[model samples]
Target: MTEHDDDRPRQPGRTVARSDPGRAMAFSDAVIAIVITVLVLDLRPPDTEPGGLLAGLLDEWPTYLAYAASYVYLAVIWLNHKAAFTRIREMDIGLQWANLGILATLALVPWPTAVIANTARTGNLADERVAVALYAIIGALLCLSWLVFFSYLARHPDLTHDHVDDDYFAHERPRALIGVLLYLAAGAAGVFIHPLVASVIFLVLPVFYGITSHGYDQGPSFLRRGAGSAKSS
Candidate 1:
């Protein structure tokens, strides 16, 4: 459909607005870039004598671990966001707010990621677990924001491109639901079990997230794919 066409299939009680999502996508990209940059800033140098710098770095393995895991997780989140927008055709009030919600929680990520790293490095099991619990709570919020964004689109399926299946957004619900549940379970483990275990759970979250991609492949789309390719080139 042409950019100006109000091509989204109409449904009872649904209002369709012809919107260009490019601006919204660009704004989201900027916000996500800032968040990723802040995450890198959280990596602190090992404070030690010149000769002992190697040992100091070794002692701060937890910091490195947390940084790596968080970095990868954020990467996955970005990829997922891009994948979703590929099918999204317009920016409505609800979708705009939903996107903001995801960004809000995502912006909080660097703080908790750093906290987890610093606390884990102290080698205090109790404090580490508390830190893990805090991190898990942040993760839950992030996942919840994603769930909200997806649900909003599901309820208003017309926001997606005509080439996309109406049920596409609805299919995403289960993964988002599972993500919330897993985050809660990890939080429980942090509070009751060991923080190290909870850290592992956080590290593996991207893999669990991959489950959502199983059916997202639509063999590329005439509307979104060509534009995406041009932008990339």
Candidate 2:
């Protein structure tokens, strides 16, 4: 639809002075770039003061694992972020604030990454478990923000491209729900099982997330209706 369309849908009890999202998206890109870089800089090299520097490097496997997992997870988030904006056509104050919520939680990712690395390195089973749990907690919050953002778009279709399916946003909610629930489950696994196992869960989750990031015209399998079925109002 053209920008001057008169019959644009809007949020109830809200004004409809939407603006282009170029500035907001550029700002978001900058924020994410800086946050992702922090993990790399946080990768401190193990001291080579021992009889062999090779052994010290080998002992940094935990560090490698934490950095790799966190980095890849952030990459998945970035990919999904780009995909989300492709459907967004306009920006409002609420949408802007919701985007900020994502950035806020994402910026803290490095802290938990460092915690996991250090705790695992010290060979502290209990602390490492707590570390993994903390990481999972942050991941859940991030996913929740994503859920809120998508839900907002679903409820306010005027903020998105006219060509996007009316039910598209509704169907996307399950992907975020899966993340929130799985992240919580990962936290429980960390507390009750091996921290390494929890980390592996964290690492594997991004694959599903990335796959689900793509849009579906009808919806996901579970959310899809039968052939010729009607969409409920």
Candidate 3:
């Protein structure tokens, strides 16, 4: 007996198959959870007599500030990651690995947070400089990761929805690039200025980017068309 070949409709062209979005999302969620947990480890128990509540609380202010800043920064990154992934239909192995690397760097945030908080409490310039440098380095890496992930999406337009066009890519690249530059500058400033001041300047980059995103999104039409053809297929 001879077996007949199955007849079925074939997808057009050489399309690359992608992995389950659930797996990627789960991995990201786990990484983020670990990061948040580690952040809490940076908090130190107040050192004072049981009844000296006010003094103990005052002594722990640096820790509180570090915790607050790190928490907010991580939350923002997580939100941005969620936004980027929500538009993704599928993920390639490379993209998954890139995301994992990003998460790994993010998970390391508690170290810098603790260092910075301790340095601030002790008023140690050397320790403060080291902590600030690490913080800025982490920021730069985060920006680079976003750029890498966005570039990957830009390369594989099919993985994203129709509305993600050249304009989004064009606007986003500059934003990420500027963030990288800003973080590097902040790291350099840590050599001279107080770490807290350098960190404040670094934090402003996110605010600036947020304010400019809408305007950049509405920029000249030329960027919209330049790479628009790539997604047409």
Candidate 4:
């Protein structure tokens, strides 16, 4: 028998299944939940007297800002991850590890958020610099994880749903890489500029990415006419 014939099962037209996507999804869900909880823990109680509630709360504006930014960042990642996995039907060992690494990095976000919030409140340059570096490092690693996941998906096109186009591979990779570069730049800028200013610049990334060449709307199959109509209305 030929190699193809020998590899085939005794039953006709049946292929052996490989990899389990569900497990990966479950793991992702658990990690996301934990990350959200950790973010809430970063919120600190006001230090003012009972009658000075308003002043005490106002003093925590930096903490509120940090929480808001971190929350939005996590939401964006979750949305992107969902979009990516929607097309995926299977996962290899490499993909699993990549996802795990992403979750690991996600868990670190709360610490940096807390540090930045505290430092900004106290107006400490050294602490602010350290917090910025930590946040940037996590962002960079998450970007790396995305690169790994995308590479696996590109290599194993068969794992994706039929509606998914091969061009998605080419489109998302560069966008993710550029985001990493921007985060790194923002982190480095914190050394010279105020950390709060650097963070504001970093926040511009999502807006830029949403409108730029590599945005989801720019994909080949995206319904541009429908989107335009919705916007005009």
Q: For model 1, state the Cα shift of residue 82 in Å.
A: 0.4
For this target, which candidate reaches the highest lDDT against the unseen true structure? 2
Collision count for each candidate, in order: 0, 0, 0, 0
**Candidate number with greatest TM-score:** 2
Q: Please, what are the lDDT tens digits per residue for candidate 3 over residues 14-85?
A: 356667577788889888888888889867677788799788888888788788877777777776677677
For model 2, the stretches where C-alpha displacement exceeds 4 angstroms are 1-13, 216-233
Q: For each candidate, what is the lDDT?
A: 0.79, 0.82, 0.71, 0.71
Poorest lDDT segment (10 consecutive residues) of candidate 2: 222-231
Q: What's the CA error at residue 231 for candidate 3, in Å?
A: 15
lDDT digits (tens) for residues 84-112 of candidate 4? 77777666566677778778877788888
- C-alpha TM-score for every candidate: 0.87, 0.89, 0.79, 0.80
> Which TM-score value belongs to model 2?
0.89
Q: Clashes in model 3: which pairs?
A: none
- How large is the C-alpha RMSD of every model relative to the true structure? 6.9, 3.1, 6.7, 7.2
Q: Distance from true position, residue 191, model 4, in Å? A: 0.9
1-233, model 1: which lDDT tens digit per residue?
Answer: 46543644566765556477888889998999898888888678888987998898888888888888888878778888888998888778889989999999989988888898888777788888888888888898898998999899988887888777776776676567777888889989988987767888898897656544433333335524543454356
**lDDT for model 2, on a 0 to 1 scale?**
0.82
Q: Clashing pairs in model 1?
A: none
| Candidate 4 off by > 4 Å | 1-17, 207-233
